[model samples]
Target chain A: MGLPPKRGDLILYSVLAVIFLASCAASGLLLFTARGGSDLVLEAVLDGKVVESVDMKSLKDESTIEIRAGGGINVLAAGPGGVKMISADCRGGDCLRMPAIDSNGDVIVCLPHRLIVRVRSRGPAKASPIDSMTY
Target chain B: MNEESSRGTMIRGPRKIGMIAVLSIVGVIGIFLIDTMDGARTVTRDGVAMNTVVSVTLVSAKPKPQLNAILDEIFALIGELDKKFSMWNEDSPLSEINRNAGISPSAADGDLYSVLETARRVAMLTDGAYDPTIGSVTRIWRDGTGEGRLPSSEDIASALPLVGCEGLKLTSGGEAYLERRGANIDLGGIAKGYALWSIRRLLREKGVGSALVNMGGDILAVGDGDGDRPWRIGIQSPSKDRGTPLCAVRAANTSIVTAGVYERRWEMEGREWTHIYDPSTGFPIEGDLLSATVISADPAEGDALSTAFMVIGPARSLDLLRILPGVDAIFVLDSDERGMEVLATPGVRDSLEMFDDEYRLTFVDVY
Candidate 1:
């Protein structure tokens, strides 16, 4: 039979086993608790006013909505999976380049046009509070 | 050989137990750290009040029901404040004082009395540039704007005599009276700021560590933002084309109040008329400045100062801001040569971040 494991070897193995299990548990919690539901609504606000809200859950087909305000226009697309700004007249193009928002509280802001597109829960899904509002 | 084996076995048993205990402690610590780093929670509620959209954001780990209850109380408090301060409310305390103008001193509530006192002091400091006794002029302008017309000069002149704050008398026992007939008081300029202070006080009393209150455009930050970051506030551009921010400021436990010509304006007969009026002339103040933002430890002061600065114009307002302690201001002006110019006090300059290249930033010396 092979030589018995030494004290140093046992200690190293025990520490490694603890770390592995801890990491696994952390990842599990993140995966299960952090994922948001698919039912989401997107609110388009212009000049601190809500102009329109499109429900992603109710949409059966992909469509685009154009908002014209303050001498600028922004086009937003809402699909079954998510919503995104497809086009805008502003110079920065930051809103257009923003990634698709699938979860609640994700915001796409066009500073030049003063337009904000934010995703929210459709039903009574738990709302995560924001720390502060800049406007 | 047997003795050696027994000694090794004894060492192994205790060592294994010690190892398990250490591992359990590590696991517990790791879990806590993960939860703390990733589980920071925030809740936001939005509603309409004071003829504007008000949003309250709170950072808490409390249950949803508890958080909802706190927000409900806040909203209800705002409603009550509206009833007390609104000039539109015929039964409001302010209306009662207005109706009893030049007749008798109306017994005011404790809060209303304090707010009026503060307004009187600010009006004196600004030399009537931020008078609360301009209710008659404001009423005419409101009606004119609603009808897409400008108030006639004769009407404005008639209202001017009653626009001075000196005509309003306040007693030591919370009694208020207007010394002149037709003189009225409108708290539109200062009421929002007072409401913000009230909200902050309520949140503090309720053990809320972090909160942001935004009533219309007036903002009050009570504590640190998420992850200890300062709250970032975007200053709206005065240009009508909207989307681009003129600048931004980071605030913590302070109030920011902005008075912009764009907030309330109407176009009639090829001219633009804003709602802000000069207490002296009883007409909208004419200036190149597009907006004035005031930052102060006191929200009420910030609110009143913003209107005062807007009325005082850029040069005189900058002078007044220098002498005022614990207050800062930013002025966005329409320059004839340059496209636009941003003049700010030292404190305001430090926190202001200008995003556009076309706009020039100038720092004014307080001393």
Candidate 2:
């Protein structure tokens, strides 16, 4: 039917398949990785002054909060296994993109906005989503 | 004969209706895509953007603003807008525009006209207290680097001649011109307020109930959050003392702006070189306390007035405030010797719930 349903369809299918394969491998790799947990403190500073700080070890599941300074803001998130930025006002969202930190010694930072996402476990960190998965 | 022909042609009503419905749905989707992709773009403000928890964007509303992203956007917009529209940026189209002045209309886009007009109006109302065309004065006393030094009396005097509201002109047809070559209208004095006005227009058109534009100390409050309780905005204490708040102001439908010497200044030769300049003398204001807060129906106007009062000083600020209507101010004069003496309009004092004995809160009410 009209040149066997167009060559474009075949190309789309192939591209999608490649993406699926890559994502599966990556997710598997992440899940299977070892989980390292520790205690971490995130301090948001402005003009070399610490405006706000949050201790991740004390948090159980998730905590969403906002802090404001002269011309900037720092957002924090703390979760059960580990803590990471769900969002921030900083220019680059690198802090948010720092992988799910299940370990205590991980630090996710946004330098431009003076933000830090630090993770530390009181005991030992559990296996992360990436750590648990295997290819 | 026409009736008979029409009667015979009248057929497939359901099919026509079905086709029309499909077309309508497709048209709606097309309009949505076009507007979302291009009509509404993510625009940031230039200069020192605020780290704000203000959840004001209607399109991206959750709760407790995602801080860093808004700051970045604000910062980027200011930078981008500056690069695009700076009259002094020599490399900018706006510089070419300023060069042309009376020769061209500065583009039909109207941003130049809007910013210039807003600046001029604010300058006039403040009686030279807040003059936008004081860039030359600010440039002379440049104090960022190692060689940062305050300009001499002659330097200020020369620039003072070039500084005034008279040098900025906006024609009736949305065309703006720099009346003088050295004269410049820095939106820095009025940009936040312009943004507040534009955002308010967008919100009203979209039927949004409440919004807050927090450009650091410059904040514009519109309506209510969740349709209940006024927005409790905190005025940062200009005190060097840590972990203490000056006071909080509650607003349902108004904009509040504060201009402080502590905001951005480099002390040189026992004098503070700040961005806010006094057109009368073409110099940074010397003051007692920390900041001057302006509350008004127009946020942009409020912003301009705040800077004007900061430059004029408190004693002279009283004379200037009286002639102005629907505008009030709170001057926190650093009473370092006598402590902090707050000179506020009756309205501004009423808003603060004073706590602790040492820190006094006052209100300035302008109806």
Candidate 3:
């Protein structure tokens, strides 16, 4: 038979158990709350068709993709951290003006070429409840 | 101490450990539940249609496969609509109608005929402010201004005569004809709204209680945003950056469409020219009003009125809104003294949440 634990021992074990449980809860929360950039998937669509879907985490080096559609050329650069339209022959060059998108739900559109590049997260992140914007 | 008491203390220590273990398990489960509370109930898909961005948001409890099928159907419908309405597409029904101008009547699809009929009605309602036959002039502006060259007076004069609704004739037998050789019909003003109107019916039929379909900037919101509250929509600011909204309105089961000169405007020779043209003048509209947003049950009406309001200016648009039932408008105008001013119809005035002091807001009385 083992010796009966002293009251001080019981108190120490109780405190340690509480601490362990609290840490477990906190770690679980952090696991869910932290947004992993690796989960981002970039989808490039041309003329209503999804032509390219690349996982950002899979690309170890920066690469450029040239998309020719609607008699226009749009150059897209995708790397580990983000994706952006580096250049486009489409009128107004609006796609070129758009900033690099790293976060989920970010979109870059070139209207003339009918090209849309957007980021989708394969995580538990919630989409905005606001329905739409009218401009 | 008694042996039994000593044994009880040892057992109590184990019990404490067991309770902690149980709590740790429960805590992990609770955290997981928090993470997946919504469980991806919202599905959003975006594509390109009608030469603009088309996005759909659906909220439902259905399994993901069913939801994905619903999204596929929606995009397919948009693609069909684009083929029927896009004038830029040389093979589109609208282009077919333009091709047969002064030559022969071209057969229009049933949907095309109905939309053209609606276009005629809107043109009459707005006193020719929303004429569909202004396509000739708009085409010239589209090509000329795109190259940073404004259309000459001679080009405007030639197209001006083609800008009347009388030139467009839609027969009950599903044939449409233009009276003049150069006359054209452009659905750019209302096609997106019509698309939204159809999408609304389709969503309702699919049992989607909450959805939002945005074709470019024309928005149709149904039910709640996320199955609980009205969908909050932002009205794009004319003077500020593109994503920055002047104000927001809570909408449910309604359509909000905005047309702005700032979207496709260019500065040349120290003058600014926009895409929205005045039917009578055959030139880009010049007025204090920079953008107009219309809210109504019918997306088509909202879409057409947003353009007509820009052509007629703020005062006349306010008068028209006072008489039009179930229709409200928000007009953004340039004020030399106030910088930017906003005039909103009474129906939407109470629902607006202003974002900044950059613009002065006034609620125009419908009475």
Candidate 4:
């Protein structure tokens, strides 16, 4: 007959299995969440060639728009918290990633996109997605 | 490497127990890796090239460093094919042969051999429904520097004598000869599809778990989309803007080739003409179909089949459909007395997820 394991041995195996399974589960969850992120490059240009581009596929979907910029260029959008970028020309990769602007009345300028970012905010009285779709 | 298991089960010997636990963990982890590696990535050989893609699952789990590399190789193979086969490429071997008409060509590689082989095969299957030797006839009605005008009956008659598939002789040494001085081979109908086929092979070799290669509308899906979802590719509705897709279908390692009059055509003598010509009369065929699409295992076959549909027109296309064993087709035509109709093979209808319009497939020989 195989030798019986001590209580300590049993406890050790139980702990290891818990650790192994937890790590696996955590990693899988992170992967599933990350996969939903989109990676798309949106380029706005006046000519056939690209004037400026922003990579915003990963940001959360917003109902209101956000816009940002530094100089001659600007971006504009509306709805649930839209996002835009600020400043560029291959200067700092800034016009590329810029930052998230959530409030209304904030203006963003980019010398590169030839764009002006305009944001419009909605009050809490606004309907949610379910109500809007039904109406 | 020491055999720690030699010792009897030790009581409170912390180091000994720790060793057993560590070894067990390592062994189990090893088992997991060995079990999963085969499903991780796959590579394939396409014609003379190789393509590799990590498992579709890995595309998310790991970096896809070689995906673009695989696509680049596919493009390279197609470019090579184009250099060899394009009638437009004056430097091609086939062009050289065309320039030296009435002489047997020396055996050679590149586009010349491919063109000859494809022409011979298409002739037998389509019963000369598709022929590469219609070059002279096509030129009589072609508008190069000026508007395209109808060739006189005499000119057409002169060109017709040089245009039959039965009129050319292909020797085993890769030589093609025209029974008459004026005949030439034009693989325009089939070259793009062949290029797509080569590209498909390149993708297959790269272990690309799944891929979709689109050259203006000739598309091939190398495998199922990365995961369980089929790759949903849209077919452009005719006469619409490029961004507007009429419909979509899921592809699982299949090719779709579409031939249309609108893709490339010319106007001459205040009249419009297309490159798809009828060898019997040597002129652009008037038909119900504005376009025809075919599904096949490879691009070249799909391309040639799509051309056959275009050549056969609506009625003959339907008849050809009945003659074909398992192939399918989709035909779009003008819907009014204005000369528009949409037609598709019965087999194609079975695979159709959705379509809008009164479409039918009938067997007739309009050509």
Best by lDDT: 3
Of the two candidates 2 and 4, the one with more favorable DockQ, higher being better, is: 4
How much does candidate 2 score in TM-score?
Answer: 0.59
Q: Per-residue lDDT of B1-367 in model 4, one digit per residue for the tens?
A: 2355444434335665688678767765655554344243322211111111101111222233465356446656665676777665699876776666676554547456666777668766776767877777766665432342467888888888887777767777767766667677777777777776666665556555565555546776766664545655555566653323444455667877777786546566787777688777777877667887776675776777777778887667667667665566667777567354455555544445433343343423322
DockQ of each: 0.12, 0.04, 0.34, 0.05
Off by over 4 Å in 2: A1-55, A58-135, B1-93, B101-105, B143-147, B226-228, B240-243, B336-338, B361-367
> Chain B of model 1: TM-score?
0.88
lDDT tens readout by residue for model 3, B97-151: 9988999999988779878888888898899999989899889887886787888
Chain A superposition TM-score per model:
0.59, 0.44, 0.60, 0.37
Candidate 2 lDDT by residue in tens digits, B7-61: 5445434444455556655655554444334321222122222232222333223
**Lowest-sum lDDT 10-residue window in model 4 chain B:** B48-57
- Which is the leading candidate under TM-score? 3
Give the TM-score ranking, best first.
3, 1, 4, 2
Give the C-alpha miss distance for residue A131 in model 1, angstroms.
7.7
Q: What docking grade does candidate 4 earn?
A: incorrect
- Chain B TM-scores, listed for every candidate in order, come to 0.88, 0.72, 0.86, 0.74
lDDT of the structure predicted as candidate 4: 0.56
lDDT at B14 for candidate 1?
60
Measured against the true structure, the TM-scores of the candidates, in listed sequence, are 0.73, 0.59, 0.78, 0.61
Inter-residue clash pairs, candidate 3: none
lDDT of 1 by residue, B1-367 (tens): 5998777666875676577767776876776666555544666776667766577888776665777788888888888888999887899999999999988999889779888988999999999999999999999888876677788998888888888888989998889999988888999999989989889889988888777888877998888665457777777778633324678888888998999887656568898788788888888878788899888988988898899998989888978877887788888888687568988888866677887666789998886
